[model samples]
Every structure is written in C-alpha cells, then in structure tokens.
Target chain A: MISIIIMNKTAADIFDEYLAAKGLRQTNQRRQILDAFISVKSHCTIADLYDVLKKKDPSIGFATVHRNLRLLCEAGLAQEIKIGSGKARFELTFGQSHHDHLICLKCGKFIEVFDMQIERLQEKLAEANDFLPRKHKLEIYGYCRQCR
Target chain B: MISIIIMNKTAADIFDEYLAAKGLRQTNQRRQILDAFISVKSHCTIADLYDVLKKKDPSIGFATVHRNLRLLCEAGLAQEIKIGSGKARFELTFGQSHHDHLICLKCGKFIEVFDMQIERLQEKLAEANDFLPRKHKLEIYGYCRQCR
Candidate 1:
C-alpha cells in the first residue's frame, strides 16, 4: 500500500467528505485508486488506471474506476479531457492548476499550457452567446514539433 | 435517393478524385451516403445518420455508413466535432464557415456560433506556446435556457 500524499494535505478528507455528501461509502479500493491516479503526472484513461491498480491489488475492475472518475470530476478533484471523440482521459486536479492541452495527433503526446488571454476570450465569447459556461474544454490537435 | 446539391456543385467529382487518389473504387453506396450526410443541416453521429438514411434506404447498413464517414472526413467534405469525450458527430464543411459550439448538457442541444475574436485569440495562444495550430475545438457545456 502506497501512502500517497496529495498536493492538498486534506486529499483523504476531501474524498471522505465527497463520499459523505453523496451518501456513498468510502472503501479501501477508492482510496487506493485515487492514490495511484495522483501518483501519475499525465492524464489517464480508465484502462490506464486499472492497469496501475490491478498490479497492486489484482482486484480493481474497470467499471469501478470509471464510476469513480465521474465522481471525482463532480467533486472537483479531477477534470476530464477530450482527446478527440475517442477514448476519455482525466487529470488529477487537486493542488493542480487548470490549463488547456495541445495534443499531437501522430504520436499521442499532450502538452499543457496556460494563457490568460485565451481564458478571457472564452469568457467574453460565452457572454456574447448567452451561455452560462459552467465548464469548457479546448484542445488543439496537430503534429507536435518532434512529429513536424 | 436525394440528389443533394452542395455549395460545391461538383461534390461527386470531388469524391471521385478523392477515391482515385486513394486507389479506392467510387461506389453508388458512397454517393448515396454522402447525399444523406450533405442534406442534414446540423451535426450527425453514425447512429443518427444511419437512422436518417435507413428510413430512406433500408439497404444501407451501419458499418457502411461508419466507413464512409471516415472517407468523407479524409476527403475533406466533413468535419468531426467532439462533444466532450463522447460520441463523434460530423457536419458538412464544404463552403460552410468555421464555428464553435455551445452544448446543453441537460437536453443534448448544440448551438453553433462564429466569433472572429475567439479565432484570433486561439492563433495568438498557439503561437505563444510554439504550437502550430492545425485545428481546434472549443465546446461550452452547461444548461440551456429551456433546461434551466
């Protein structure tokens, strides 16, 4: 069992409160899965997370990971990323800042970048359209420098 | 069989040239599928298109529509939109100007908007990050007025 310390010292408490607010029970498996997810630096899909946890516990299933991911997003502990209209991937958001992605089409590489001007433009655009803009995702897919 | 005339009068010719370039045979089914796709005003998923075409031509199967969709994308007659990391939807791009979307999560509604400012901001951000932006998508997800 890896004692994964999160960026927020209250990560375990956050998870516990999330489960409590949702009237759900906290299990050993959920703690283990979040630990593994926080350990990885890049984005992860359910299959990727399953592979990581199964090696440690040998009992984690894909569906549990998938359900937990949705919960984590709802709890503001993680964020979902759109890598085209294909396989879904997520990043840990606890103690992490928000940014958009530049994904390489040829090599499946992701580079995270933050730009204040872009964020302002999005808010302005949403206001113009009468969109409440609870959440949004912006992804640029093309050949990265290495692939180019 | 709807004789769909698009912005480009020579759409079939374009398909023919694409097929020839790829060493693929231009078939009647491809033409019919293109006809159905071009006729729709909004975005369409494979199942959405199949349902639309199956009513017109029961002979067309799901796999055939799916395969031709890829060819249409490759041929540059269509553009794919990622509604989050969910199902793939496409729109006819020939002679249509570029735009982004505001999606209603509660009701599954898509509202397209064109903004010059958004486009300019994206180019600037990509340049700042040294990312050559080939293509980009921005989708704002929230409740529409009706759903709200």
Candidate 2:
C-alpha cells in the first residue's frame, strides 16, 4: 500500500497557473475553498468543504463552492469522485499522484491507495482494445474493519 | 478487447428468484423494464431506459423504471455505472461479467471491456491493504476512434 503524501506544489500554485493561462480571476472565496480542500486529509463533498469554509467566510454559498471545484478539475488540481451513494466527491490530485479508493459502505468512509501493478495492467488493457485512455477510476466498496 | 456476449439466463429468471425470496410481487411493469434492459446493447441511464419503455407502455413512469432498476441491482441482474458525468447509468451483470468501461468524453459513449490481468492486479492490491473486497468500478475516459 502506498502512503498518502502531500504534493510539493500545492493546489494554489496549480490553480494560479491555470487561471493565468485562462485569464480567470482568483477570487477570495475561491482561495478559501482551495485552502480548505488542501487541508483536508481525505475526500470531501462540496458541502463538507463548505461547512469548514463558511465558518471563516459566511458569504460563501454552495453554488460558488461547486463552480470553483469544477474549475479546479479543469485546472488539474482536483478530481471528481463517486462511491455508489450517487453524490459526487472531490479529491486533490496531481498528474503523477493517481490512486484508487477503498470505500466503506456502512460508515461512508474512504481510503486512498496506490498500486503500480494495477496501473500497468490498465495500460495493457487499453492498448489491447486500441482505446487511448486518458483517465480512469477504481473504487472498491465494502464494510471496513471497524464496521465489520 | 472482449466481445459482448448475451447471458444464458434471462433477467426475468434472475429477478423472479430474487422477488420470490423477498416475498415481492413481480409486477407487469417490472417485467417490461427488464425486457427493455435485456434488449439494450449497452449501458443506459434510468432516463434512457425509461424513454424506450415509455414508447411501448405510455403508462410507465420514470419513478417506476428507477425503482425496478434498483430492484434489478439488488437481484444481481443489473449494475449501476458512471463515467465522471455525475448521472448514474446501469448495465446487466452476471456473476461472471467482471468488466470495466472505456468512456468517450467527446460523444458521451461508454464501451465495456474486460481483462483478467486487471482483475488479478486489483485482487492483489486489496489483499495488500487487508481489505475484504466486495465490488469495484473502473471507467477510463477519452475520445473514441470516430471522435479522435
């Protein structure tokens, strides 16, 4: 199992570059969302991040949080995630920090893990199918140890 | 690339056992939904299936289609799928299916394909983490040949 490590360049750096190239403004609330997202230790929904950010900036709304996250994905600083609950979650990601998820169905808990072997096997499958793969998601769901 | 093969047992057979074991009635509408799903050649969302079913039975409601699809999932006759587009989609799944998706972002198309090597690698990852695996989803997204 690969340990979760912080990226050397933060989401702010990535977003700034993205905004500069795209000619987008980096608003204060957007910055706050980025900070809360960066500080989170695991995957979180928009509401989860908003609860934390709203305490600092009550003016922030759910739609604003949602829009910024969409931008973050376009900027390659975050990725959308789903774990069978029909709600979308977001997680910080880098070009090289790709991983899969182990979700706890009973407790709504998620664990991030990485495996080089799985990555290689996916490349082989895509090649065999003649499909040029850009991105992939693998989520394993079951009762966690504590829940079991 | 694996060829899509029809399952030996029909959805009605699988769902009948499921409904009988649960002491649930197999309604006529439920039967129609199952038929449309069985006839479908690829993954479909509730709206997509509902549209097709409505053409045959104008009385069929979206909620009814959604509910029956949920039951189909409980009976192991169908599997819910998504490819980073937020909306939930579903496909048929026998115990032996064990495939993943290659989604086309440009045209919103999804292709199902399987690989034994990918499955074995996932098992290895789960074992390494002491996770008792239950279910998993892998969706790779990019342009299809036509789109490219």
Q: Which candidate has the top score in lDDT?
A: 1
| Runs off by more than 4 Å, candidate 2 | A1-10, A94-96, B1-10, B94-96
TM per candidate comes to 0.87, 0.86
lDDT (tens digit, per residue) of candidate 1 on B1-148: 3344555556677788899998999787898888888776568899999998899789988999999998988998888776665678889876577888888888889988778877887777777677778888887777676776
Task: Tell me the DockQ of each model, to 2 decimals.
Answer: 0.61, 0.63
Worst 10 residues of 1 chain B by lDDT: B1-10
What is the Cα-based lDDT of residue A84 in candidate 2? 60
**Candidate 1: how close is chain B to the reference, as a TM-score?**
0.87
Interface RMSD of 2: 1.5
Q: How accurate is candidate 2 locally (lDDT)?
A: 0.79
| lDDT at B128, model 1 | 69
Clashing pairs in 1: none
**Chain A superposition TM-score, candidate 2:** 0.86
